[model samples]
Target: MRFLPILLSAAILAAPASAALKDEAGITEGLIVVGIAYEISRVCPDIDARRLRGLSYLLSLKSAARQMGYSPAEIEAFIDDKAEKRKLEAVARDRLAGMGAVRGDVAGHCAVGRTEVARDTNIGRLLAPR
Candidate 1:
């Protein structure tokens, strides 16, 4: 009976350390942030994707996730998951839309991109002036 309390306490303390990769905000949100930068650069006339930095950031995320116990297959599946992709894309689209992006208006996207760039945000870190 005495050992039971200690066991429960140990499990409680250990639970958070073994948390899943998907729950890690840095890597997961980094994907969305980087994706936003890439999309903005794609449509924004004055913006360009920082190709090497983007690639390196992604690689670092993969490495960090793996270090946190995520398997390569698991990471790939998360990255490729259609549902997750749609969800993240929707979020990105909403963010851009909120910043004045319109379907056919490159200028709007450019403005948003330039603003993000000027702010030096996570999204802007993946983009550069064209």
Candidate 2:
């Protein structure tokens, strides 16, 4: 019975801090682009790079928007915004190229079989569309 009060107090204290962090750390369009670019640069081979980059960007944006408390409608609206998408795509492209230059054969090192890459990095799971 005594432990119950302590637990409740702890929960109360933790809740506001978590809420504050969520509010402050809302996902940005730039972040979604860079995240997708980074993930694709790490895992995808050059042969499949363009397709994987597009898919990864959409997945990352959806996941990040949901995490930041955006509603489905809002997410759809954001997706529909062509200007935003174009900007993000340009940023993603640049970041991907930069990563390629710096990493020097990222795909050669990291692009194992899909099953192996999935098992090793868990990136397949993270970037999968929900």
Candidate 3:
């Protein structure tokens, strides 16, 4: 899968809404491309791109949440919720002091890595494996 579409989508999202008619299509297409690329890479380690790209995406989300005035308690709630889904997200508050440096796309890389791990072993297998 190609990721050009994802980057294109980001560009379209960056564009003004009034002038988005033509660019919207490309943006949509780019996102699809990026998603496909991400999935393909997740299934095949040999093709996975650098993990940093995914890390950047995660950081962006955290930044957005911060801008939205999420309180410390609120952020703690979020961390608690995410901890069940991802162990690393449950890091101690003290350890998170410098977590601002963590990129957003780290989630993507984590997802891909998890997928690869699941594929290689039954570590995360449910009651049954389909």
Best by TM-score: 1
Cα RMSD, model 2: 15.9
Regions of candidate 2 where Cα sits further than 4 Å from its true position: 1-64, 101-130
Among the numbered candidates, top lDDT falls to: 1
lDDT value for model 1: 0.67
Considering lDDT, which of the candidate structures 1 and 3 is the better prediction for this target?
Answer: 1
Which pairs of residues clash in candidate 2, taking residues 3 or more apart in a chain or in different chains? none
What does candidate 1's lDDT look like per residue over 1-130, in tens digits? 0111221122112212222565778876876776677777778778988877877777788788889887766776666555555666676677777879865578987888888889998877778987
In order of lDDT, best first, we have 1, 2, 3
* Candidate 2 residue-wise lDDT, 35-56, digit = tens: 4434453444542323344445
What candidate 3 gets wrong by more than 4 Å, as runs, is 1-39, 82-130
Writing each residue's lDDT as its tens digit, candidate 3 over 20-45 gives: 12133332232232343344344433
State in Å the error of residue 67, model 3.
0.5
Q: C-alpha displacement of 3 in model 3, angstroms?
A: 18
TM-score of each: 0.77, 0.37, 0.31
When 2 and 3 are scored with lDDT, the better candidate is 2
Q: What lDDT, from 0 to 1, does candidate 2 have?
A: 0.40
lDDT of 3: 0.34
